[model samples]
Target: MKLLIYCLNYAPELTGIGKYAAEQAEWLAMHGHDVRVITSHPYYPAWRVADDHCGWRYQREQRAGVTVFRAPLWVPHTPSSIKRLLHLASFALCSLPLLAAQWRWRPEVIFLVEPPLACSPAALAFARLRHCKAWLHIQDYEVEAAFALGLLKHPWLELAASALERHALMHFDRISTISSSMLSLARRKAVPDERLVYLPNWADLAIAPSASSVALRSALGIPAHAVAALYSGNMGNKQGLEILAEAARLLAGETGIHFIFCGAGPGRALLEQRCQDLPQVHFLALQPAEQFPALLGAADIHLLPQRADAADLVLPSKLAGMLASGRPVIATAEAGTELASLVSQFGIVTPPGDAQAMVRALQALAERPARRGLFGAAGKAWAASHLDRHAVLARLESELRRLTEGGGAGTRGTTLEGLGEK
Candidate 1:
């Protein structure tokens, strides 16, 4: 099977959507599928490219087995609506012309990633134009995500965006999400049950932790003595790092447990400032995604905290990475979160944002290090059986194959009849 993935973020960008897209592309290529990724120049999480790729507009690169084509973009990385809209518009406009040209030359089943729903229009149109089918990968319910972050305000705009998303999902060949909750939400909004698929985040074996290093520990100033509770990923608003800070406030001056957060985001500076006044907490800025295996290998325990509102639309993408790193997760978020399920699926959950509970769990895990093995073992077992990248790409391949083969992929309406299940 030959497939093309169109997304706003891709390799070199450390955002959730970027990582997942790259992983799937790599796996499909490895499995002998002809894979191509059409994405904009790298800039995400922090919204700025690294010092090297600064002036480069567009280029083609090879990642594993995938053929990657880059396009120029002018959107700022920050969250302001004007800049975001510009960014979205730039990708959609730039991507469409190239993708349209690419289609004429080399057509394949296209997969569209949401937010920059503008991107979806072109990919969807191109698929239709080519007399082909496309699968829409819905990660977060973007409009709801914005509302969860307190960015969405106008009710009419919400309705319009909701309608647009529904139209896209209903018309697309298949719509796969990262969680059951999101699948339910997608159905409620109007996706046909058969066309809908649930493709949760999976651990990248290539990125899992290797042997622990004393040099690595010393380099980060992590003492050979202290018990470390690490949160390594985005420190964005959706993560509810403030709640983790509240947990830190409760554990302040405690000698046994320590917190190490390593990642970058719009919220990192605020997080650093929040922890500065509160001692016993350390903040490290973002590291390269390539370094994840070694960087995350050192955690004694992992923290996954989501803003209660965030759990609805945004699944903590970091959970997959954490689980893959072979460490036990200590997650606190809204009830019923798929991530929180990792804690239970592995049997180690505390209520969302409860400082006392976090402190106690921290102490217990600190005192008994062997439980980390059990947690990690469960995650590895589950991931290997269910959520590995290769498995997900296979499921994706099958779904897209069905679409290309004119198999069953029905659409649903607002009434949601026969939706959310198939």
Candidate 2:
């Protein structure tokens, strides 16, 4: 099977969709599929193109059996709604020539990653020209999320943009998204059930912790007796991370509990400013991937926060890693939101932006070691069963193979049932 993955982000981005897309492409190649990825240079979580890739308009390289084609993208120093749109547009526009150039080496399938839904038409054109199936795997519902999160608020513009996105969505042969809630949103956009595939995000179960890092608590400056509540991942607007600072402020007198915020993003400065006065808080930069297990293992609890408006539009890809780390999570989500419903069994949920509620949840967990242990164990077990990386990718590969061999359109939504069984 020959597969072409079209995404704005790819390997070395270190977070979010890029990480997963790179993994998927490499895994397919290793499993005997001819995989080719067309993507923009790494610029995520940090939002700046890496130093070495600064001058290149285009670069092609082979990484572990996968053919990678990197296109130039306009990176904004500080991302606003319009600037971010331009950023996606830059990549989409720049990659079109490359997509057209791939006509000779016709791939069996062209899988597109959405965010820059602006590129859908280009991908559809490539698929049409190549006479192959076009698949869309959405990492974020950007159009709706923009309005819902107040990132873009003109009523007329919202209607026009949504109409355009809806039109682009209908042209794809197969549309897969990360969460059931996200799939439901796709359905609400009038995408027929037959077109939707539930391809949930997965966890890296193979990560091994370093034995020497067991003293990570002391290394992070937290005392042995302090209960560390950690928030680690991209600090962005959608994260509603201000609540962490508020919760820390509310619990500042509780010396037994400590708050640690790790990872960098546009929101990092704001988070640091907000929590600067709080002595119980510590902020760390993103650690190396190999140190993930030890870093995650050091935390007594993990914190995940999603804005109320953006909760359903995007599922935090970081949640899967946290669950796999065997640490109890405390997330801010409304009572019946998708995240709350999904995590109810494995972690504690509080209303979004509610500092008092978060403080209470943190206090409750910090005082109850037995309850924390139970939640951690349950999360670990669930991740092993549901978020296994190989199993998820194998299922995806099988579906893609069936789609291509069966002549394009899949078994009319049958993959959803298979996903449910898993």
Candidate 3:
């Protein structure tokens, strides 16, 4: 099968959607499928393009058997609502020629990743023009999230954007998202039940603690007995990371508890400023892929904080890694949401943005080594059963094959029965 993945982020971005997008493309390529990616240069979680990819021109490269085409875009140093839209628009406009150039390739499936739903129209139109299937995999519901998070406040604009979103969504041959709640949202947007697919994010269960894990802990100067509470991945507005700074401040006198904030984004500078006076807090830039597993293993507890409004709209991709790391997680999520339910199974869930609750949860786990061990074991077990990368990708490949073989469009919605509970 020949597949073209259109998305705004891709490889070398290290965390979030890019990591998964690149992984999927490479997996498909390795599995005897022809995979190509149309994406912008590495600018995610950091909001700045990598130095090597800063040139304002189109470039192509081969990565792990996959053909990757990088299109240049404007990345805002300090991204605001308007700036973010402009940023996404830049990619959509710049990548058009690249998309058009693929006319001769005539991919069997055009798998579009959302967040820059800005590119949806072009992707859909191109798929129609080539008589190929158009598959949309939504990692984030940017239209709804923007309004819900107050990133865009005009009611009229919200209505207009939502209408446009629905129009684009209704035209797709297949639509997949990372969570059941998101799938439900797609259905609410008038996407037929038969078109919705639940494609959950997956984890690499093969990752394990190594010598580098100990080295990382030592290098960070975490006391031998101290509990490391880590919040790793993008430091973005939707993360509600300010609560973490507050939680760290409240726990400042607890010498045996340390906080580590890793990864970069528009919110990192503010988070650093807020934590500057907290001696127990430390920060690190996003680690290399080779060191990521070690970084996960170094944490005694993983912290996942989400803004209440952003909850359910976007599930953090980092959760899979945290669970796979065999570490206890303390996540801020509302009751009844998928994130809360999942974390409650193997870790702890506090109401979103509740610093006091987060602090309490951290303190409770800090003193209970046995309980921590139980949670870690349970989380690892769950990840192995439900989030193994091979299983998830194999299912995706099967779906792609089915779609290319002309069996997907009218099929019933793929149930999550074996993957996990709805």
Identify the runs in model 2 with alpha carbons over 4 angstroms from their true place. 207-212, 407-422
Q: Report the lDDT of model 2 for residue 340.
A: 91
Better of 1 and 2 by TM-score: 2
TM agreement with the true structure for every prediction: 0.89, 0.95, 0.97
Among these predictions, the greatest TM-score belongs to 3
What is the alpha-carbon lDDT of model 1 when measured against the actual structure? Answer: 0.73
* 322 Cα displacement, candidate 3 (Å): 0.5
Can you write out model 1's per-residue Cα lDDT over 219-316, one digit (the tens) per residue? Answer: 66767787778887776767777767777878887866778878877778877877887656777766666666777776767888776777758777
Ranking by lDDT: 3, 2, 1
**What ranking emerges by TM-score with the best candidate at the front?**
3, 2, 1
Best of the candidates, lDDT: 3
Residues 231-330 of candidate 2: C-alpha lDDT, one tens digit per residue: 9888887999989999999998999999889887889999999998988898887777777777887788899989998878898999998888877899
In the range 1-422, model 3's lDDT, one tens digit per residue, is 99999988898889999999999999889989999999999988888888788737899999999988988799889888888878888999999999999999999999999988889999999999999999999999999899888888878878878876887798988899987788878877888876777788899886777889889889989988999999999988899999999999999899999988999988999999999998889999999998899999889999999998988899899999999999999999999988898899778999987899999999999999999899999999988887888888887887788788876442244433357232
Q: What CA RMSD would candidate 2 show? A: 2.0
CA deviation > 4 Å runs, candidate 3: 408-417, 420-422
Which regions of candidate 1 fall more than 4 Å away from where they truly are? 54-56, 206-212, 277-279, 409-422
Q: Is candidate 1 or candidate 3 better by TM-score?
A: 3
